[model samples]
Target: MDYLQYAFFRNAVIGILIISVAAAMIGTYIITRRMVSITGGITHACFGGLGLGYYLGISPVFMAAVFAVTSSMGVEWIASRYRIREDSAIAVIWSLGMALGILFVFLTPGYVPELNGFLFGNILTIGTSDLWAFAAYTVVLVTFFALFRRTIIACAFDSDFAQVSGLPVRFINYAMTVLVAVCIVLTIRLVGIMLLLSMVTVPVLIAETWSRRFISIMLAAIVISIVSSLGGLLVATIIDVPCSAIIVLLQVALYFVARIGKDISLKRPIR
Candidate 1:
């Protein structure tokens, strides 16, 4: 209970809630469009920005956001206009980003501190500034979804049909890709690059087992993420384990439970 009085703990809670909401909302689109691999590529690509930031003495999170957005848009351009396969583009960017990050970190004069935190996450490091940035992202994501739900849905399910229907499919695709990149960067501090993909994918998978509707999945994922994150935080604090790892483990455990429950329901006799 005394820990609740600490500002860092409060900030961590706020940051996780905001990240959970954003990741859930963006993850629904990623799952629906089958862009999980693309999202993973973007998340890894942010490491380049992190390393560069360390070398340049700037904020790594900001640089990570820049790298992620650029990588996402670059993938879109290369795949759509340059005649490269999407997966191929993701692979190129993923490798290049990691290589660049390694080079930059190696060149940095001093031993880079806090690199492990970005790699594996430490919720206790979250500060008020990070919370504000997350809040801003959440607002932008919610506003975008609220204003263009139908178009976004159409694009996610069938881009060709959406384009034929005059829904600006290309524009929606670019916008969502950028948003996905931003969400990845924002949440990296929570779960780190290594485990960030699961933060976006696992809850959505569990939610999908129960509902096919996009909004339902998003809401369910948000709830599941919040519960798991908070519960993991509590357990990690008590056990003195890595918070991010604990959170991911909790999410995996929930996924199995949800899967089992889903299977049991499917086997039950109809009334």
Candidate 2:
């Protein structure tokens, strides 16, 4: 409670709430579309942006957004345009992003800034600008979801059928991909590049074990994310532990709880 007095802690709380909503939405979509692997690819791709930004002495978050979006789109582009496999494209871009990141980092001049914070987590140091970026992205994501709920569902569930039905599947895919990339970049501030995938996914995975519907999963995921995230923050302050690890651990702990409940319910007598 006392930690709330600090502006950075307050900013972290707000960022967690805002980003959790977008994360739930995007994570649900990713899970539905079976594109979870791309989350890792995009996360790594943002490292390229971070390295580039550090090398150029610019804002790492901004460069991360650029790299995240470009690499994500690049994966889709090469796969669609050149008939390359999607996994193959992801692997190539993943490697390229890492390679570029390392190269740029190594080339940075005069005592390079420590990137471990960006690598592991930055919630404790998140600023007003980062909060604004997350808020803006959340607004855009909610609007997109609201306007095209059915279309998004159709595309997520059956892209081939959606394409056959003239539902603008390609547009939806690319649009969502870009949205996802930006979301990933914004989220890096919360849990950093290494652990962000779990922040989005572990909640959705827990929610999935509880509900089958997309909306249910999304709502449940949001709740799980908010709880685990905020709870992690507060608990970390009390125990002086890392917020990212606490958040991830809480989410994983909830998954096991959900699994236990599910197993127990299955053992009950039929109604």
lDDT of each: 0.93, 0.91
Q: Put down candidate 1 lDDT per residue, 1-271, tens digits, no spaces.
A: 7898999999988898899999889889999998899988998899999999999999998999999999999999999998887899999999999999999999999899899999999889998888999999899999999999999999999988999889988889999999999999988889999999999999999999999999999999999999999999999999999999999999999999999999899999999
Best by lDDT: 1
* Candidate 2 lDDT score relative to the true structure: 0.91
Give candidate 2's error at residue 180 in angstroms: 0.4
Candidate 2 structure quality by residue, lDDT tens digits, 1-271:
7767889888989988999999999999999998998999999988999999999999887898999999999988998999977888999989989999999998998765558888898687888988888888899999999999999999999999999998999999999999999999888878989999998798999999979998999999999999998999888889999999999999999999999999999999998
Candidate 1 local lDDT, residue 258:
93
lDDT of 1 at 9: 91
